[model samples]
Target chain A: MSEFQNPKARKRGLVIQEMPGEMLVYDTETNKAHCLNDSAAFVWASCDGVNTISDIVREFEANSKGTVTEDFVWLAIDQLSSKGLLEAKVEPKFKGKSRRDVLKTIGLVSVAALPIIASLAAPQSALAATSCNCSSNSDCALQAGMCTTQMCDNRGMTPSFTCVA
Target chain B: MTSLQYGQNFISFGVAIRFESTNARLLQKAVKTANKALIGNLKPTQKPPEHTFVFGRNKELGTFVEHNGSIVAENEIERGVFKYFDSYLRVRIGEYCPDRVFVHSGAVGINGKALLIPGNSFSGKSTLVLELVKLGAEYFSDEFAILDKHGRVHPYARPINMRTTDGKYRPYTVDVSDKADLKKRKPLPVGAVLFTSYKANAPFRPKRLSPAEGIMTIAPYTLPILVNPAYSIQVLHEVMNGALIVKSKRTHAPRFGEKLLQYLAKVM
Candidate 1:
């Protein structure tokens, strides 16, 4: 990662919803959903394959979001890149440093809120959350090899479902 | 191949389905079972069914249920066949329904607004919903919260299948149809969404979720999310915009339901 290098946000295969002080981005390719707070959303919006790290910091200040250090902008970039929101993957700048140390250093001098993105993977099959009764391995709700069911045995009573590896 | 002796076409949530059976008696039983599976969600349709389910008996397979030519469930007991088909049909409809999104949630209405508690089976949602109904909140559903394109919740008021306190935790249905004013039931605007699971003796300290965070939390339980990501996200945005979303760990249903109503009465 370089301060002079320009970054672009990935726009393809994503569904985004902009809400008050937050943005929701769903990656259709990976089935991952990310919730970006205002600070991170601003940084992502500014990444148009044109703005350098220094330029993003200046834009942040111009928008009256308060003064932010270049390190703070890097923190958001590292997260966005790792989450596959960037057009090109950037090597993590804080690879060897603990997140708490980085946050502490950024929080000490930056007046703006710390950038945070919360993410969750949408299940490939919603049936994974619900119960399923299967007569064969193929009918199991979960991914292959993780779930296998026993032969259906009711014997004139309620059905019993058994899972075996 | 066994000749299909009886069949019926039905529409549920805009998804057309046909149920066929080699035995006339089994077909009649299946019709009754399908009605219970969706509650008031199903109706007869003239359109060709997009999915077809067949029920039949054979010497080798005994009794079986098939969907689109694949065997879904097989058992010697007739009761088990219908039980498995009931669950299968619900999941199928939830997965492919074109017009509505089905979330595995328990919904109730208070002051004409719906409160949705989203969770999978055995999460104690049914117990909480029953308690809420006992406390005079109008019961919407104990299984699913069917959301239309506008994000309004329509009632899927089926009998609450409450798990027994015995060690087995077997489910038993408690019919509240007498209490559910189905004649007057209509779609209710979402007032709030609560994400909670039973944790014995855990204090009910709910933290508010941002709209974006709320959508992320509910995405896994949303059935059509993977099928139609754009439409699902659009509807979820509509839901979180006007609704209060919160998450917490709850204690027993009776005690927590009482406290929850008080908390909602103040906040919502």
Candidate 2:
């Protein structure tokens, strides 16, 4: 296993919406919205550049009323880094370990096995917003430092083909 | 800022437009059509509106503008006027409503709370909502669910926007007060969230969703989440408390509506 280090959340252009047990994070920089479950949210919020892997696992155990292993924190950190939610990339400690080895090593419940982050690309406005029904690609909004490819593809529904990107 | 007054007032989404113009007949037609398209047949009150804006027609240019008191559009007055009106009403509601999070979803009252169905265009939201309404559920809205900070839902009543078989869109309004079949209801807390759509030959199979899953499913349809992410997240989170969320695929609405309500009653 690699040495553990504190992680930090990215600070710019990030909007977070919290539900009862999950967080919806909209990263304007990437033009993507991510849904982090309670476990993942807790891990992300706890990343203060101070909490080590062992510290996070203890915090999870205290609040979740369940046991967790350091591997769980590592799994979450892996996802956060991949999604650009972290300030820096985190190297997975179990790089050489297979899925079976990791599961056996952690010995956590199914729910605590790992964190899951679901995401989707959302338009700047509603699908029915006038901007979405653009006349051409020039009219489509720019995202991630690039112009979104816009085309008409509604199969002649009503006003013919409505623009989509 | 030119100010003209003719003592005519029209209100929608708590925003008022005091009509002021020499073209009184045209002003009346514009108000009526705009009200029909944006708001239901709500009674105009003597109490002052929350926000007031002046509306006037430019007889010379054959155009009109409200709120900003500028020539926002010129020519094609009929279409331009209502389009601008719709946009203004939407913005006004979002700005004025402090506690409500405006979500782009169809909602109906079931079990003294709301059943919100979230989806975008071509997702069969309207068709499913119509079915729920036909099955004796109180209609909240076909387009938006005005969810309060406490998570209760208020009515944003408007005509149902339905597409005909030929793919032509049309608005159909239901007179709840007069309709004997439809039940009358007030704003209620959210009891359930259904993430569903019509699928050909897809059996009425439903999978329950966690609160996290529910938030993600509805996130795309919640308008306020996009506008004020931090505040919206908290509001929607609280709004979802004690609500049953289901992700389901069904072959039909009328048949599935019965089963769905039964499921909600048992769970909620």
Candidate 3:
């Protein structure tokens, strides 16, 4: 792990919307949207560039979030770092351990829900979701009037156009 | 090539556009088509157009439609020209509309609250919306759920396009305004957002989604998401704030619609 004990959340190039118990973070840089559950949101909010992992554990417990260990906090940091939500990437503390194994260890002791971040890549172009009645690449080229290479996706019950790089 | 002779400017949802044509007859047809596409949202505007569309016929390209001086669609048949223009105009307005967020959704008002089913074309949203309307729900739209800044849903009640089940998926339009009393439709507070698609023999078991998760689920169907991400996310956040979001797979629209209304009544 890096020597920097205080982890900061990345605020640049991100649009955040806080909900009842969850938070939606859109990374404009990567065009990815992440839904951070309550536990993860708490940990992310606590990462103010001054709180160490141990400090976050105490804060998480004091907030009536159930007793959590450093391992639990590390788990959230690992995910946040990997998703580019953290300002500085932190090396995985559980280096060689499988995620299932790590979660199993964390799940046994923690009473609160484990921190989870669900993510999805936003569409490259909004038109991809629109209906296009085309059966071939040439048809999409003519219909959409774009010069880029595109293919007709017929796997679904209906056909649509998907841009190909 | 025939020089464009007639042109008209229209403003809809805060976006201004101009349509021109070489033939006067075709220009009127284009105006009529644009009005239908926006469900009468277009209004005459003297302001300069932000985007200009030209429809004309020539020996080289035959019948063609051009947007911003680029040929978007060209065909030998004039009928294809209007069809292409209708689709193109809807997408362009949806992308650039400054005051509203257009989601590819089917919306219906039930008990004065709106239920939005967000999906793309051929996702069976139109079919489900038709079934709901038949069950006495007020129809809002089958193509778009126009959302205001406060996340209230306004009616975009165009004619529902139903796909024929003859394996060709040809669509036929159905106007439910007479039966649904769409003239009385008003903006409604969103009560629920259902994300589901038709699957063969699939049972309707719904999974509740968190607000953030709900935004992610509907992001792809949001028209201005790429054009204005901040505004789109803000509006979507308002939508998810007070609405129930669920995902499920269903077998048929009629049966599923009945069950869904019942389930919503008990839960919502």
Candidate 4:
């Protein structure tokens, strides 16, 4: 496993929304929404296949208007990887180092918090349930009105539902 | 082609629900109820509906809604009806709303600005909004705060859907005289976003949340934020800009409502 592979980061069908100092990414694949801090956003944006770990660090420092080590960039990468936001999974580089140790190594530069990505499971739209093709009940489990039984009607056309319990 | 006869009824926020039922009376009642909820004091929409929900009910299956043509809900009529309505509003409002963002929160206009209490269904949004309404704040909505593109809150005042003593989702019209009597108040800029939930014996403790925190906290309860994330994010950023976002936990709703007004007065 290329643990040190420069992360070829591309949001997995995610749409990024920028706030005053943070970013909210809607992961279309997982239906989860993630909040990226300024540093995390910078690191994520810089994680193009072309940029190496050092490039991320430099970008973070420049964008955050502060100093952070390779650990800061790694921390963001770790989070993005864990959230499945990255197109290809990259192993965490902090093999022997802990978060506290990395923080201490980087020292307390200037920032509200370390680059962090916080997320929550988002609620789906109501019509998301019957809006798909299904053959069994479990297919509608994640939908707003979960299906108890699924039936494929009209052969190739979109499956219509009788009811949901 | 099972001869499932159905008709469409337009609802609030430019959504339409199509119902299929053998019981003509039940279907008519449901459509009437939905229309009453939609056109409260406002003119009926002439625009065609954008989405259609096909629901059916019978003796053996009791009541059920079909998604695509498959059964999604069954056995409970009230549950099925409300589920259909909730799903339709949640989906279509966000889908067609190019101008507003929907928050699953209770909103009230206090001193010319909107005070929004954001939470999930069981998070005491309706109860808290009702309490605020009794305290002389004009009710915007108990279920949603439809925030326009300019960050102002509009009234989506469907009769405050509340759990009756018998544990049914009945319309609570304590503040509004009739279910169809909706107030056509001008949209107000959001003064504060209160992220609160009721707790037993927990004192009202409030902590200020940053705009990002506020958006993140309310994202789950917001419609279209997940489906149309890009537009949702843009709308939310505008909707939450310059608004005070406070996370509070309280046991007493009336006391919390009073304190909320006091807090808004100071902040706004």
Candidate 5:
């Protein structure tokens, strides 16, 4: 929306380094590295700057087989962008490779907001993987990577996480 | 397996695990510090029944743990569930067991590869790593897993070059035999690295550690300089050696073994 990007900015602004058991983001401005452990890595990768924050939230829904709200994505993104790691790029020009992904007709798809899933049940080694049966955002009480064996959703979501009986 | 009240401060709820293959110097050092520093801090409580715990089923280990309320084991693999509660930490062992790393404290999990188990105790490191082999993780070594200057995981030993569960400690096992023991000696390359923290809510999260962060995490673990200062320098260089590093949360066991196996198969 705003033409604030510098034309001569180098690509030296962001660096992603994968080390033993960790993911790190190096910010040029602060000369500091922000680390993302295992679960965070999954979120960081799908937080594509090209997509609106809502689009990225949907990506996690698809990945976790769960749904979450637009606000969650915005909350996550705003925090990341505030660190100067994310930069807005001008929309790419129409190119031949882009055509392969889809028909170019402009259209609209219904976007549903899903709540975080927080299961408290302890994980069992033999439980069957349930299909994404969630219908709304309220179904997910657990956010992403919860420790303690299972999810911790007390209300507003079905119990999925395993806990000590 | 007798209780000699070693410390006034360190109160152990659930079970207190002791290493049978005793390296007295290290044990005494750890215990003595607890005795001196834990006077006002130690508090004993009823074992939380919900704090479900497990240990090697060997009759010998069971007897020892029963008498001592602590299992003294190392060099042998005990694939079972167990939990330990302390004031500062609650260890869940044997969930998704971590892979072994060759460092000053003994074997530990590699940083960022696919193994899911992380635990305390240097001796258990290699035994748990052996278990990682069962989950389809590439076998490294049982002892002295090393970090190269380029940040790659190298083998410090082949099989676990540590002590074994011999003598009176033999009954607590599904397989009570001399051959099933995890003995010391050998090295291999590490594909992943992990930094482990002990907390209850901690689940298996395989993460990628940044190079500088890797150096920081490896610092405390690599402290007291196991070999020469050069070895630590070598470890520092090796931490940056290009393998993956991760931070893990563990309690009691090779926690998160099955789930980790499931997750790693897709990632690595």
Candidate 6:
């Protein structure tokens, strides 16, 4: 089980929440909601402290079977920026998750790990781990933003849960 | 440059109208009454007075004008409007500002959220709108509404501009009892362009329209449909971006206005 922690990357002006099948982005200026599809969702999910734009591109490229490119990632970022989504944060690259490291490691990762990471990066699963399920859903006897279903040992991962019924 | 003062508040404008001819003189009472509205409560923002001159202009404003062998009063029809230069519109509480700049026959001091209705005659444009006032909709303006460059349509709560049985609009005449500026014209961007069709018995029908089609439908509502293609495109682009355009119709005027109001309640 892997932990999905997004570093300070989303942007200053938006509120991003993970839903069941889609990721919802709320733009405060227009008071509107914009959603991301599977591909866009992949890029948005990879906007974590451990990933760079190159990492996002590589992951998306693998998902699309190498049909996308770096230029497409840049263009997508531009489109998101225009839609008031991805804002310029001026964040320096993390010591371990640098661009070159991403290019090299991403080149080595097995295509087998793509779907696994995608499932782990499930927008709803990420949200289930973060939000206060105990407060909103009375049945949620669990803490917020963590997999509410079951508790694990030192795995640091949320285990699958089942309903009482 | 005479300034209009309402009660104790004085709002000045760069453009001023002076009654110089018999037709204009006829509208003096209406202008003065309209000025009372300007002075009473409708506050438009005011700008510092500026001065400029147009090269070819004739006759002062608010008077009957003789053009091309036909007598058209400024109150009757908008003519030579191309001659205006450096005009500005402002809407604030007590400052003398233009209610709308793109207007042909405008009066300052009027106030309200301008509800624009632009459509060809017999489109039930005036009938449904007048009925709206009867059904508790505030009267913004009659025909034309004023729009800014950014396409913000001002809301001027003037009297309803309905064609009376005698064929004229109803102006607010309580305080002054003057001859009304019955047929003044302005090219207002429709706040809700109901591209309507009058029916004989069907219930009022209101539908949402794409912004593009609304613009195309609203252009003709502006006074003076000249031969200029650019004119249609210009007005069309602005109205499309700035306001909510819909397709509304009713069997009769009463149900039409009520349903139109009901639809606006959902959107606005």
Please list the C-alpha lDDT of all candidates, in the order they appear: 0.83, 0.65, 0.83, 0.66, 0.36, 0.39
Instruction: DockQ each candidate and list the results.
Output: 0.35, 0.20, 0.30, 0.27, 0.05, 0.01
For residues A60-102, write the lDDT of model 4, one tens digit per residue: 6666548766766777888889898777877766767887887
Question: What is the alpha-carbon lDDT of model 4 when measured against the actual structure?
Answer: 0.66
TM-score of model 1 vs. true structure: 0.87
In terms of DockQ, the best-performing candidate is 1
Specify the poorest-scoring 10-residue window by lDDT in model 4 chain B: B37-46
RMSD of each: 5.2, 7.3, 5.0, 6.7, 17.7, 24.6
In candidate 1, residue B63 scores what lDDT? 85
Candidate 6 Cα outliers beyond 4 Å, as residue runs? A1-165, B1-64, B67-115, B120-124, B156-158, B161-191, B224-236
Runs of candidate 5 exceeding 4 Å displacement? A1-165, B1-102, B105-127, B147-189, B198-201, B223-235, B251-255
Question: lDDT tens string, model 3, B85-151?
Answer: 6766887798899979999999999998999999877688999999999999988999899999999
Report backbone clashes per prediction.
Answer: 0, 1, 0, 20, 119, 19
Following a full C-alpha superposition, what root-mean-square deviation does model 1 have from the true structure? 5.2
Write candidate 2's Cα lDDT for B45-104 as tens digits.
665555444445565755555454544333444554555455445644553455568787
Each candidate's TM vs. the true structure? 0.87, 0.70, 0.86, 0.78, 0.30, 0.35
The residue-level lDDT of candidate 1 at B246 comes to: 96
Q: For model 3, what is the error of residue B45's alpha carbon versus the real structure, in angstroms, after optimal superposition?
A: 0.7
- Per-prediction TM-score of chain B? 0.94, 0.73, 0.95, 0.79, 0.40, 0.48
Docking class of 5: incorrect
Give interface RMSD, per candidate: 7.2, 9.8, 7.6, 7.2, 16.4, 30.5
Among these predictions, the greatest TM-score belongs to 1
Native contacts conserved, per model: 0.53, 0.23, 0.41, 0.38, 0.04, 0.00
List, residue by residue over A1-165, the lDDT tens digit for candidate 5. 232221111235544555544455544344344555443454456644345545565676777634555444443343344444455433333334343232222112223322111111111211101112223323322322211222221111134322110
Q: Which ten residues in a row have the lowest lDDT in candidate 1 chain B?
A: B163-172
